[model samples]
Target chain A: EADIYQTPRYLVIGTGKKITLECSQTMGHDKMYWYQQDPGMELHLIHYSYGVNSTEKGDLSSESTVSRIRTEHFPLTLESARPSHTSQYLCASSSSDRNTEAFFGQGTRLTVV
Target chain B: AQSVSQHNHHVILSEAASLELGCNYSYGGTVNLFWYVQYPGQHLQLLLKYFSGDPLVKGIKGFEAEFIKSKFSFNLRKPSVQWSDTAEYFCAVDIMNRDDKIIFGKGTRLHILP
Candidate 1:
């Protein structure tokens, strides 16, 4: 079973509102990532953390910010929501071993009106 | 940046029919290939991966893929597909040892007629 979990499986908010998507894992993995995907589209990595307190931007630029204080939690926050922010946010966690498979969460679909 | 391509956006097939989905990637350096499946309302799950070994690799649920170095392709195939196989399949590529970053294709949606 996948140890990763994302909260608020679905969310709807108004524009200009601040929001955060919660992500947690119980696998004790060192690597965590957040990806954004639209309906039936490719996934784009937006943020990643190699370890606690080490966050980096991914290939895709994103307006969301993430923080990793503990190994299990990695939350993505949007200062101000916009219509374009509507998409599915997926959280994944992986161990330190090379070629190790990643575990993904159920994903949180957010819609900003 | 490396990119993956899924030639077929959608495919329809009958039960017990053969299935093949083409995948190609553009990366000059050594890379790892993988196939992931997502059933309806389910999260994505790894089907199989090609790290280093024989070109042909088999995955769970009667799925297999052949990695062609020259063509930079890793196509997924199943001799006979069941109705339960109806889902979206994605091909992903990551640089060797760089498990943190993986480039994914748009994914192919397969529909099996019962």
Candidate 2:
């Protein structure tokens, strides 16, 4: 089983509410990523971190922001949640070793009403 | 930019039927290939991967994939599929000498009927 974990497996919040999705890993991986996915659709990378204090945006532009202050934790925050922000957020982590596979968390389903 | 493509959007098959899902990448240099499966209400799991030699790679749950460099394709196959095999499969590529980010394809949904 993967050591990565996402909090609040499901979330529902009103519009304009500030919310943060938590992600943590115990594998001591150097790389962490956040992806957005919809029902029956492909996952799109939104943000990633190489290590502490290192963050980069992914191919898909996202309104949310992420921070990697600790090696095992990478949290994403939405300034003001909107209906458009409603989607499934998945967190994953992988070692820096070459050819290694990535492990994923159960994912958080966010619903902005 | 490196990108992965899965030709089939959705597939339906019966139990004990052969299965093949097509995947192609657009990179010329060395690349690492991967196949990930997501069962219902479950997180994505690594089905198989190809990093170096041996184009033919086998994975868990009786799944396998072939990496054809000439065709820039890494197609997944299974001799006989079970109804429990129904899930979403994603093809991903990690281009060496580039960023560490792994690009994922749109994904293929497989539905196996009993």
Candidate 3:
């Protein structure tokens, strides 16, 4: 398994509440990414960070924001959760080398009702 | 813009069956390719990847993928599959241009019935 870990493996919260999904890796990789996926559906890139303090939105326009305060930590936050935010959030990290493969955390399943 | 496509959405097969999942990408530049698998209640795991060199790349769990640059396709194949192979498989592409922010296909769910 990847050294990456995600907190609150599963979460169910009320709509309009604020929440943050935590992701941390011990591999010391410089690149981290977040993807949103529905069960058995497509995985959409929501956010990514090249390194500390370098975060960017992905092809998918997500309402959530992400921060890369540290190399091992990347967190995604929702200002106001909604049903549309209900999905599996995946966190991954890879070495700075262009050819290295990415490793993924177990994922966080969030349900906003 | 780049895109990855998995032609098969859901597949049903019996044990010992040969497997093939089509994956094609649309990118005019050099890129990296990967296949990831996610079992029920588990996080995604890298099955294999092709960064350079040989067209055929072998991955974990007896799976392999062939990167056909001419076709702009990286299709995954396994000679013989087991019931344990049942899982959701995803094809991803990371163009060298964008710091390699990977893009994933809509995934293919395989069911290996015993």
Candidate 4:
């Protein structure tokens, strides 16, 4: 089984609230990523970290930011959540090897009302 | 910019029917391709992947995909599909050494008739 985990499987919060989606992986992977996906839609890359203390914005622009303080933890924070931010957030991790597959978390579904 | 494309938005098939899903990428150089499946209310999981060697890669649940480099396509196929196979399938591409991001297609929702 994949060791990645995300907190708050489901969340309903008021708009403008600052929220942080937690993601942690016990696989000791060097490549970690966060993707945003809507119901029945495609997954859009939002943030990724190559290694500890190295984070980069993904192809899709996102208002949220992520920090990789430790290899096992990567958290995404939304300064002020909006209705547009209501979507499922998925976390994934993979080894640095080019041939390896990524392991994914269960995902956190957020609802901003 | 590189992109992944899934030609079929949704597909409906009966049990024991042959299935095929088309996927194409717009990268010319070496790439690592993957197929991921997400069953209803479940997390995404790796169905299969192709990094090198044989182009025909078999995955879990009796699914397989062939990587045709000349056509820039990696199409997924299954001889006989079951109801448990109902899920959303995503095709992902990683452009080797050019970028660290893994781009995914819009995904095709597969529905199997019981």
Q: What is the TM-score of chain B alone in each candidate?
A: 0.95, 0.97, 0.97, 0.98
How many pairs of residues collide in model 4?
A: 0
Q: State the lDDT of candidate 1 residue by residue for B1-114, as single tens digits.
A: 678999999999999999999999988778878999999999999999998889999999999999999999999999999999999999988766454577789999999999
lDDT per model vs. reference? 0.91, 0.95, 0.93, 0.95
When sorted by lDDT, best at the front, the candidate numbers are 4, 2, 3, 1
lDDT of 2 by residue, A1-108 (tens): 999999989999999999999999999999999999999888899998889999999999999999999999999999999999999999999998888888999999
lDDT of 2 by residue, B29-108 (tens): 88889999999999999999999999999999999999999999999999999999999999988777647788889999
Q: In model 1 chain B, where is the ten-residue run with the lowest total lDDT?
A: B94-103
Enumerate the candidates' DockQ scores in order.
0.74, 0.83, 0.91, 0.92
Model 1 global lDDT (CA atoms, 0 to 1)? 0.91
Off by over 4 Å in 2: none
Cα error, candidate 1, residue A84 (Å):
1.2
Quote the positional error of residue A77 for candidate 1 in Å: 0.5
Error of 3 at A69 (Å): 1.1
Docking class of 4: high
> What are the per-residue Cα lDDT tens digits for candidate 3 across B27-112?
98989999999898888888999989999999988999999999999999999999999999999998889557889999999999
Residue B60 alpha-carbon offset, candidate 3, angstroms? 1.9
TM-score of candidate 3 versus the correct structure, residues matched by position: 0.97
Report lDDT (Cα) of residue B65, candidate 2.
100
User: For every model shown, what is its TM-score relative to the native structure?
Assistant: 0.95, 0.98, 0.97, 0.99
